[model samples]
Target chain A: MTGYLVRRTGQMVLTLFLIITFTFFLVQAQPGDYASFYVLNPDLPPEVKDQIRAAFGLDKPAWQQYLIHLKNTFTGNLGVSFGNFPRPVLDVLVERVPRTLVLFLTATAVSFYIGFFLGKAMAWRRGGLFEYATTISGALLFTAFTPAFGLMMIWAFAFKLGWFPVGKFLDPLVWRGADVSANYVFGNMLLSAAAFIAFALLVMLCLKRFGRRVPSVAAFPIVLGGALIIVAAWALSGIGGLALDIVKHMVLPVATLTLISFAGTMLLTRNSMLETIREDYVMAARAKGLPDKLVRDRHAARNAMLPIVTSLVYSLIFAIDGSVIIESVFSWPGTGLTLLQAVRSEDLPLVMGAMLFIGMLSLLAHVIVDVLYVYLDPRIRYQ
Target chain B: MTDRHDPLLKVDGLSLSYQTRLGEVQAVRNVSFELARGSALGLVGESGCGKTSIANCLMRLLPDNARLSAGRVLLDGQDILPLAEEDMRLLRWRRISMVFQAAMNVLDPVYRVGRQIIEAIETHGVESTDTAARERVARLFRMVGLDPQLMERYPHEFSGGMRQRAVIAMALSCDPDLMIADEPITALDVIVQDRILRELKAIQQQLDMSIIYISHDIAVVAEVTDVVGVMYAGRLVEMGDTSDVFRAPAHPYTAALMSSFPSVSGERRPLTGLPGEPPNLSDLPQGCPFHPRCAYATDVCRTQYPPQARYGSHWAVCWHPLDATMAVQS
Candidate 1:
């Protein structure tokens, strides 16, 4: 475990370095710098504009400016915004990072857990009614209008029916103070943690209990109830309220993203399972007087999961890059949205910061997947 | 009348066919045999002669397209063909288990070998406690001549022979009454094959389990099995005690098969290879399927199929049986 952690941390540092290098060069290659934005503002005196440019070291060579940016980034100084906000780029990111993490993490957890078991079910009952329905729905929902699909859902639930708030981070009333009472804070934290644990446990138990059996009458109702309860509890809490609002705002985007992602994952898992099931060892497992479900899960599914794991890591990296469109559609303040704003305003520091963060995240995802590949499959190992 | 001393498995007039996009392919036709309890019966044939197909049908492991056109497979006294999928699941691995070819590669690489066995046991409602399951797994490993300590290792950690042994241990986990070993030693080296066969024989003696062993090697079958069946064109051409079939093969195909292998005793004879490939099931020649390849083909042999004739305990499905006169002349 210690060795794994050490390797992962080393890889993470290398990834960050690459991200910083790429961001530095890419930002320098852009047409204009922070000085160009200031030059466009006619109200400012020419001397004052030159003084402002000099203050930020914009007049220096691009290479020198890049070194200064790197030093400032390391020392917790992201420099000022170009849109006259007078705030550091880091502060803007800090305020929005939590919101994005909450929304994305929740969606990821929900989608992964749900999609995995559903895919398993579809594979197990390849020709049955439930499997047929899921395959068709999954293909249709994901293949058609991925991004617009999310908007369609938002229109139906929030705009058409007024079932939930349409778009925003939160109500802002609940989390107004950073240093709230310990009891309230702890209570909220415990509730959120407990909820997460419960949902995870429920998903695991469902997968375990009904893994082999055909789709029972109770399957759909039980899953629907569980999803409803989770959504309700999440929308009711302070942090959850913020998360729920983001989710509601994200309903269309996530749905669109999940459709395409689900298609890829489901196709991969189904093919792997099908191939693994035909292996001679599978017959050996069946010959052991083991039940069909046990043979499928413990023998077939476990082996098939190796490829799925790799695909998931690649998907995560792709997701970070793909979030730009979703961010624009929802108007949710995130790195993707902030980067776009920086590009338009010619804020070189902010653009580099956002790009570097995304690039690092992608690299980190890749490293994590590579390390896990070795552990999950004994065939792989570092020399 | 059901003989109390009869074999544990009896497959009578079994005919199996598979439907493909082209047409129906008759893979196994009118095959009949019995496996005495605690004894091994070897099914030997070339690749397309339906050895594996027969095994699959006996285990009811055929794909969705295959159909058992005729005959009955009696496990003890129960018919296996009409059994429900769930009922088959119950009987499989418990009453009748299989050790398939290339089975070493079948272990779940993600899990430890011990946990996999434990999962198998728990799935069948064997051991409720982890301790009990571990103890059972250890006992199984010991029975297969493997160290119990190695159970914690992953499948990839074990050598080929060791992995096959682990698979054997799993097959024996439930103390199955009948174990179908389908070319279990085919993929191993000659040395490892000898070792695994020896271990299997010992385990059979200890447990008194009947095994339906399938192989293409006539010599290997002679060493391990009491009775042997030689198949040709999806049909059993000859079947009898191993000594009887090897010493005096009635069916020409069986005679050809025996001569194909060089005997260790240096009693060498010119091998008479079968002419032409095995019949294509979708478009088989009329009448006797083997007549086209048989040297003693006549008008009767080409016009009508031969019925199985019993001579003592041995049976042969040939119009012109290789009696002493024919054998000497050939």
Candidate 2:
């Protein structure tokens, strides 16, 4: 397995290199560079525009410019953003990527758990009314366009009902400066640590109490109890109102992403589970006198989970590409929105920077998935 | 004829049907057999004759669409039909386990072979501690001619025969009272098949448990079974002691089946193939299911279902039962 990981890591590096090479050339292949945007300004003279081009090395041949970009990238110099002149591309990305990551990563995790378990239940009660209802509704959610769905959510929940704010990451009117003081940050960190320790103790308690009675399902309460404790600890801290406001702002966009992806994930899980439930091993498990739940979870769900895991890895890899349309629709200031504006304004530095990060993310995600495969399937020998 | 002293397993008039999109298929019809303790009964038949269905019914392992439409499956003194699904689950594996036909593919590929068996043992609440279960699993592996160390490997890591042995070890883990081996060695090579059969016979003797061995190969069944029943078109056409059934088949279908198999040390008789095919269960012929393929089939055979005819303890479904005196006359 170690050997396999090493080989896969090498392959991932090569893949990322190829992706960077292609993206760099392709973005440059356009008629002009970011300097052309400056040419359109009435106050700028043609000679001044020419100087700006030379200073930025856009006036150099494509090969020379590419080599320069490669050297700068290797030296950790992402260059100044043309869109926001004098600001480094890496600095701009560092500010925006985490927000996008938090939003999409949380949404993906929430939707996966919901969809996967719901799909398993649907398959178990196959041909029943519950199955039909979930299948039909899940299909509708899966097939709906993302932008349209996001808009509908915004219209219904935000605009018409006024249940949520129309849009933006925060309500600036309420908090004035919503960023918390460093003292609060330190306090929250301590609380978070306390919550983590408490959660671990809770799980041990649950295991001691219920593990022997229900050996197959003892871990479930630990996860559930742990989540409750962490959330409770956060809410009980002095900054609960601020956290609540952020969660409130997150509702619409997160819901839209969750609903849309939940359908597809659930459907995929259901179909794969249906196929797995029919395998001869399932029958063997059943014949072993295992209860219905254990048979489904231990024997059937583990096998059905393979395809779902693959899709999950691919989704994570592409997540950095941003949910561009959803971000635009919600007016969420994430990297996806940044990528769109950068491309439209022909900010070559920012575009290349974002693309590089995305390419790296994809390669890293692939390696992580390969590593996880060894744990999920023992038959997968590294050699 | 059931009493307090009835056989360990008595399947009386067992019938099952599957409801598909097309229609209902009567997979097993009025199939009855008794298995005493410490004996093996082989149900021999071609494909689609409901051999596997019967095995499934015994374990209550049928799919959602398939139902045990009629009859009672008596395990010891308890009728399994009326048992709650939850209760039936307890009966399965612990009381009556099954080795599926695709034995090689019947283990979870993601888990170690030993872990899979341990899962069964643990699920059935056989052992309180993991170490005790591990020790039992190792013993089972050795009993089935497998190395205890090989238990750490996944299903895909083992060869076909080894996988079958693992499956057998799993079935025996709980020390079930009845083991239903559904064509356990059909997919294996000749040498592996012989070895597995020998291992199975040894296990049977050592464990002293009844087995319902379902297979298509008469020769394979003869080597392992004390009693044999020949099925045609979902009906048991002939049944008796294995030796009597093989030496003197009362039913023409059984006789034809016995004649088709080549003998290693006997007169070289040209093999006679049974003509035509088994009738479809959804739309069976009006009379005897085997009439079209039976050379001895008469007008009465084609017009109505044959009554049960007896010779000593052996029995067959036939209108014109072969005479015993004719054996000397011939």
Candidate 3:
């Protein structure tokens, strides 16, 4: 474990270096000059414009300017925003980071859970009517015109039906008071405590009923009930309303993204599972009088999940990028939307910051997947 | 030992065919055999002689394309051909099991060896507790002469011979009455094969389980089985008590197989190979499937497929039997 952590840490450092260097070069490559905005101001004198340029070290050569920018970045300053915002770029990003995380993480967890189980169901009952319908509908939903599909969903569900509050952040006053910092801290703590209690209760219940012989018919409903209770409790505190609103807003995008992602995951998993069933070990499992479910779960699915795990982890990077379009269509205030706006305005610092964030996320996901691979597949470990 | 009891398995007029793009291929044609309780019967044949197909039919593990054209496989007097999948699964591993040839690759590499075996045990409601299952697994490992500590290791960690033993241990986990070992030792080295065969013989004696041992090697079958059935072109050409058939072989195919292998204790002679390849099942000859390959084929042999003719307890399917005069000419 130490060796693996050391190797991963080394890789992380290398990844950070590469991302920072690339961001530096790419940001400098933008066409518009940083001082051009100040230059456009008629009231500003020539001396003041030159002083402003000299203050940020923009008057130096591009390479020298890049070095100064890197130095300021390492010193916890992301220079200043080009949009005339007084706050440093890093502070502004930090303020928006939590909201972006709330949206992205919710969408990710919800879509993944729904897609994975739905795919499993389709694969299990492969040739049935439900499976055929899911396959066809999933195909059409995720077609090249997914953004258009998102628009149609908004038109039908949000605009015409008015089932959900259309495209805007919720009023903070509904969940918290005027003092944003105190409200944020207090709400986070209460939610965390509630989540902890709920999780503890769940674990205790699962442990208590671990070996009980429950009827199969009652199993799914019981589990679902437990999950609902946990989710309800976790979303009970301040920002919970905001989180709920976010989830409601996320539904169409999540469903749209899941539709696109599910096609490949479903196809790959079904094929792999079918192939695994034909393997000699599956026959051995049967010859040992193992029940079909046990054989499939313990023997077949465990081994077959190796390829899917890799694909799922690798696809996360693509998913992150894909969310850019989804965020734009849904008008969600996420890093994806921020990055898009930054790109349009050619805000180098903001765009580079977003890119750096994405690059790190991709790297982190890859590291996690590599470690999981070793756990899921024994052959790699000893080999 | 000679108590009168009905055979554990009776396969009557079993014929299997596959509907391929070319045509229907009669893989196993009119094969019949009986395996008594606590006895081993060997089905010896060359490659493509329908040996594996017969095994598949017995287990009802045939692919979608293959059809059981005609047959009734009775397991202890119960017809298995028309049994539901669930019922068949209940009988499988608990009453009837099969050990395939490639035993090493048969294990799930992701799980621990003991966990895989425990999964099998628990699936059949053999043991419930982890401790009890571990104990049972340990006993099984000891039975197969493997260390129980190795249970935590994955499949890839073990050697080929050990993996085969592990598979056999898993097969015996349910204590099935009939174990079909389909060329179990064919993929192993000669020394390992000898060890496995001996181990199988000992296990058979201890458990008193009937075994249907399929192989292509005549001498290996002779060493392990009490009754040997020689197959040619999907048909059982000859079958009888091992010594009775070996001492005075009545079938020409059996004579050819015996002559092809170099005997450990026999006079040296020119090695004789079978005349022609086994005929393609889809385009088999009308008169006899083996007539094209048989050296002693006559006009009658070319026109009519011979029926099994009984000589004492032994049976031979031939138009012309090898007499003393005919043996000299051959």
Candidate 4:
């Protein structure tokens, strides 16, 4: 397993390198460079324009610039954003990537879990009311154009019902009075929870070493302690006022992403499960007198999960990539928004940087999925 | 000394049909049989002759569209048809279990052989502890002539014969009173088939459990089963002791079935194939299901359904049932 991991990691690194180089050339090949904005300016002199060109390294050969860009990327330097002028590409991305991650990660997780269980349940007793309703609705949502869906949701919930914020990640009016120290307190609380869990594990190991059966609820104290810490942090931070604002602003975008993505997840899970439940092993499980639920869950779902697992990993990348259009639609600040801004202004450096980050993330997701796939599917040999 | 009052399994007038898009298919029609304790009965038939359907009905594991329209499947004199789903589950795998057809693919490919068997043991609420259930699984693997160490391997890693043995071991996990084996060895080669049959017979004798072995092979049925029922077009056409039925088949279908195979003692008689296909259940012929394919089928046979003709201990569903006197004359 270690050998397989090592080999796969090596392959991932090589693939990422190839992808970065390819994207860099492609983005550079676009009609105009970032320095053209100065060239087109009426107030600029010929020497000033040449100096501006030299400043951005436009005078260098494309190959030389690409080699330098590669070196800089390897050395953790993503260069400067021509669109946001003089700001480092790393700094721009650092500010925006986390927001996208937070938004889409929540959306992805909620959709996957809900879709997975719902799909399994629907297929277990297929041709029933629930199956028919869910499958038809899932198909409709899956086939619906995403941006249009987002717009329709905004129109219905935000405009018509006037329940949620139309767009944005924060409500400035509510933020003015609310305490922002909740994030700090929450981080500390999480750290203490981790420490408690480690202590609990240690105690369990000690009990096992002394030849005692560790109680099943031995970690209950740690869990309770963690809950108390979180509650204390919640109280101390005065976050209730801030939470409503955040949740209100978050509703439209999150709902849009979840509604669109979950349909695919549901359909994938349903189709896979439907095929699996008909397998001879599932019949054998039923013949063994396993309960209906047990036959579906243990025998059917576990086998059906191979396709779902693969889709889940790819969906993670899709969720992140989809933030490009979603953030644009919602006017949210994220890596996708930054990439859009970079492309519109023809900022080659920033575009390449964003592409590299996405490429790396996709590579990482693939590697993780490959490892998990090997573990889940017995037929998949490491070699 | 077989008594009607105390049979372990009494399947009476068990009729099942599937509600298909075209119409209701009469998959099994009024099939009746009784299995005594510590004995093995084989239901031999061609594909789709309602043999597997009977096994499924015995397990109450029918598909969604299929319904047990009329039947009383009594285990230990308690009718199981009226039992709630929950109660039926409790009876399944504990009182009665099944070894499904295509044993090569019966065990889940993703799970270990041991895990799959232990699931059967644990799900029945027998030996709830993981360790205890696992030990039982290991013991079962050894019981079925497989190495306990190889129990951890996945289905693909094991040979076809070994997988079939693993399936048998799983069926035998709960030590149920009756085991319904539905064409268990059909997917295996002749060599592996014989080995599994011998092992199965040995286990049956040692465990002293009743068995309803369903198969298409007459030789295989005769090898392990004491009593045999020959099914044709969704009905048991003839049923008696294995030796008796093979020696002098009472029904025309059974005669055709037996003669289809070559006998070592007899001269090389011309091999004759039973003509035509089994009648479609949805649009069956008006009278006898087998009349179109039977050589002795006459006007009476084509126009009227045959009633059960009893000859001492044996019975056949035929108007002109063959007998020992007729066999001697022929």
Candidate 5:
């Protein structure tokens, strides 16, 4: 298993290298660089335009610039963003990526919960009205156009109902004269979510170590406690109102993403679930006298989760690309939106940096899914 | 009847069908049988003759589309058919566990073999503590000729024969009174099949419990079973002591099965195949299900289903029961 992980990590690095090489050349191969407009401007003198080209390092040939780019990338120098001039691309990303993550992660987690829950029930109680309704609706949600659906979600829940902000990431009124930036709060939200997950995992591990009866029963309280801690910490913080404003702004986008993406999970889960319920192990489990619930959940649904887990991770990374559309639709200023604007303005450094980030994120997620499969499915550990 | 043993399981007129696109399939039809305590009964038949349906009915593990239609499964004088789902669950694996075919890979691939067995033991409250349950599993592993350490390994880690043995150990985890092994070794190699059969017979005797094995292989059944039942088209055609049925098969289907098998005692007969395929379950032949394939099938056989006929202690459903004098080298 360790050997497999090592090999997978090597493959991932190799894959990331290839992706970076291709993306750098492809984005560079475009008609012009970030200084193209300034270089073309007749209003500016030739020397001044040359200085502009030299300033952004576009005066060098593509090959020399490629070598420098390679060296800088290897040394973790993403360079300064021309679009957000005077700001380092990494800092810009650091400020924005977490918001996308905060939005994306919440949406993914919520959808997974709803999808998996409904999926198991729909599969278990097949050939019923609930099954039909969930199946049809899930398919519709999955097939629906994201922008239109986002608009509808905004139209109904935000515009008409006025339950949430119509657009953007935060209320400027809440942030005025505030000590902290929205970026700071977004970073903390992501950190708190990670910490909670780690805490839950630790509790699960301890429960597993001590053994049965109380593990499942005890996990509930521990998780609830962990959640309570996160909530309490957030409530007591100075940026509590700022965070609330961001959350209120988040409702429309998050709800839209959740609604649109949940169908993919639900449909996959339902199909996987249907296949597993017919498995021989399910019958054997029942014959072993396991209760209806245990047989369905432990033996059947547990096996069904293998594909869903891998799909979930891949789609989360995959959703990064989709989220460009999402971030634009709701005017959410995440990295997806930034990446898009950078591309439009030919902000070469920001574009390349954002592309590399997205690429690396997907590659890492793939490895995580592969590694996770080795644990979730014992059969894969051998390979 | 030769010093009748007490019956541990009495399945009376049990009927079962499955709802399919083609319409209802009468999978098991009026199948009635009694399995004695401390005995191994083998139900032998062709692939689609409802052998597994019978086993499933006894285990109450039928699929959603399947309908019992009518039946009574009396386990130790308790009519288990009408028992509540929860009550049946309590009785299953605790009182009457089942072993599925080895080819089915019945063990959950994610769980360790030992953990799976321990789950069965745990589910039925067979052991007071997890430690004691592990001990029981270890003992069962030993009984089935598996290393206790191998229990920690996942199902995919075990060989087909080892997995079958693991399945056997799982079936015996709760020390149930009755066990139904449905084509348990059909997927195993010849050597493994022999070893599993020997271990199964030994376990049945050692534990003094009843075992019901459903198989299409007559020789395999003969090696492990004390009594044998021959089924045709979802109906038990012939049944009696294994030796009696093998020697004086009264039903033509039974005769065909006996003749098709290699026999050391009987005079050598050319291996003759039963002429036609088994009838489709949805639309069975009007009379005895085996008539279309029975060489001795008469007009009465085609017109009406046969009544029970006796050939010494063995009974068969046939219009023209084979004479005892014609027994395999009596």
Candidate 6:
């Protein structure tokens, strides 16, 4: 295990180095740098243009600048953003990341929960109205154009119904009274959600270790408690208004992402579950005299989860890559949106940072998926 | 003597069919038999000959497409055919459990072997406590010649024979009155098959339980079963005491099947194959389903379905009996 971890860490570092070098050179090779804004200005004199170019490091040779970039990135100095000057690239990315995390991670979690649940239902007692309806609708939704859907969602929910904000991450009006930043609240929400998940897993671990079932009813109180705890913590910290504002702003995009992505997981789960139910073990489980519920959940659905879990982990890692279209459509300030802006304005520092982050996360996701595979599926454990 | 008043199980006129795309596949037709309290019965036939269908029907574990056209499965005089799913669930594993075909795949690979068996035990509420249920599983593992410590291992970790034994241990978890072992050891090697059959025979005697061992191999079943029923193309062609049927072998199909196998202890003889395939259930011949394959098939065999004809204590559904004195009386 130690060897595996060490090997994966080395691979991740190498891959990130390649990503940093590749994106850095690609953005550097663009026709002009960020200082071209000043050079193109008729009002600016040649000497002033040269000063601006030097300040932005565009006056140096491409190879010379590449060396500085490699050293800074390696030393964790992502450098200052030319577009959002005076602020380091790391600070800007850190601010935008939690918002993207809060949005896409929530969507992924919600979609998976719905998908796995409904997919199991569809496969267990197939040919039902519920199964057909969901399958038909899920397939259509899965293939639907995300941009058009996101726009329709904004039009219907925001423009027509006057529900939720039209765009952006937070309402300046609410934040005027509250001193807390929206990013701080989004960060806290992610932490609290993570805590609740850890707690739920701990509860399940205890129950499973004892060979006791985690009764369905028992989950309700724990979930209710987790919600209450999160709410109380946010309210007591006096940033409930700020958190609510961010949530309100997130509604349209999150809803759109969830609905579209829900179909993918649902259909994948349904197909995988269909195959799993036909496995001889499922028949053996039934012959074991397990009631319909236990047989479906324990024997069939759990086995069906292998492929879905793999798909989910890879998708979640790409969530760090962020959705350019989703973020742009909503005008949400996230890594994807910022990456787009940086690329357009030739902000090499910011774009390289985003690419390196995604590359590192992608490798980490592979490691995580492999570890989970060994844990969830014993057949692969030996191999 | 068998208990006429209350046999362990009485499957009366049990017929089952599946509604497939090709129309109704009559998998099992009017198959009836009674199992005594402490004896093992073996149902042997060629593949796709309704042997498995009978096992599934007895456990009430047929697929969604299957229809139990007619039957009364009486366990302790209680007809279980009309029982609701909820009621049948309670009856299953507590009354009639099954170790399915290819016992290697019977265990879910994700769960530990002991947990899967414990699930069977806990489902029936057989044990008072979880620890007791686990202990029962440990005892069962030991009973089936598996180490109790190995119970925590997954199905993939165990060898093919070990998996079969684990499945056997699981079937015995609730100690049902009758255990239907459908091709239980067919997937294992010859050496493991002999060991498992021996263990199974010992377990049946030690627990005083009835078992219906279903197999296509007549030789394997003959060794472990007290009574043997031979089926062909969805019908029970012959049934009698194992020794009686093995020795006399009245039906031509039975005689062919017997000769198909090389007997280990008997005098040396060349093995013979029963030519032609078992007729498709949906598109069977006009008369006796096995007549096309039977060497002694005649005009009477082709014109009418044969009913059960007795020859002393043994009964066979055949137009002609091999024994010279047995007249064709149904």
On DockQ, the leading prediction is 6
Q: Model 1: per-residue lDDT, tens digit, A53-99? A: 78778789888887887788778677877663688777766655554
lDDT (Cα, 0-100) at B221 in candidate 1? 87
Q: What are the per-residue Cα lDDT tens digits for candidate 5 across A165-203?
A: 889988888788998877788778777879999999999
Which residue pairs clash within candidate 2? none
> Candidate 2's residue-wise lDDT over A1-383, tens digit each?
57766888788767766766787887887777777877779999999999988888889988988888888887888898988888999988876666676678778878899999998998888787888888888889877887888889989999899999877766766566657753354346445646766777677677766554555346666767777877787778756676666668778888888887787678888899999998999988888888888899988999999888899887665545646777888888778888889988778888888878777767777767777877798767568
RMSD of 2: 3.6
Model 6, residue B250: distance off in Å is 0.7
| Interface RMSD per candidate | 2.2, 0.8, 1.6, 1.0, 1.1, 0.9
DockQ for all models, in order?
0.63, 0.81, 0.67, 0.71, 0.75, 0.83
Compose the digit string of candidate 1's lDDT tens values, residues B1-330.
667697689899999999999999999988888888899889998888899999888778888899989999998878989999888877777777778777767687777898777766766767767688899999999888899999999988998889899888887777788888888888888899898899898888888888888988888888888889988889888888988888888888887777777787757777666678877878877778888888887888988888777655578888898873433221
**Model 4: docking quality category:** medium
Where model 5 places Cα greater than 4 Å from the true spot, the runs are A1-10, A39-43, B1-6, B264-268, B324-330
Name the regions of candidate 1 deviating beyond 4 angstroms. Answer: A1-14, A127-147, A171-253, B1-4, B126-128, B270-272, B324-330
> lDDT at A179 for candidate 4?
49
- All candidates' TM-scores? 0.87, 0.92, 0.89, 0.90, 0.95, 0.97
Worst lDDT run of 10 residues, candidate 3 chain B, spans B321-330
What TM-score does the first chain of candidate 3 have? 0.80
Error of 6 at B238 (Å): 1.1
Docking quality of model 3: it rates as medium
Q: Could you give candidate 4's per-residue lDDT for residues A279-311 as a string of tens digits? A: 999988887877788788878988888899889
Per-residue lDDT of candidate 3, residues B20-96 (tens digit)? 99989889988888989999999988898999898878777787789888989988888999999888877777788
Cα lDDT tens digits, model 4, B1-330, are 435448888899999999999999998999998888999999998888999988888878888899888989988888988889888888888988888887777889898888888877877778867788888988998999999988889999999899988888988999999998888898888888888899999999999999999988777888899999999878898898888787778898998887777765668898777789877888889788898898888999988998876655567888777774543211
Which of the CAPRI classes, incorrect, acceptable, medium or high, describes model 5?
medium
Give lDDT: candidate 5, residue B124: 86
Candidate 6, DockQ to 2 decimals? 0.83
Q: State the lDDT at A228 in candidate 4.
A: 77
Clashing pairs in 6: none
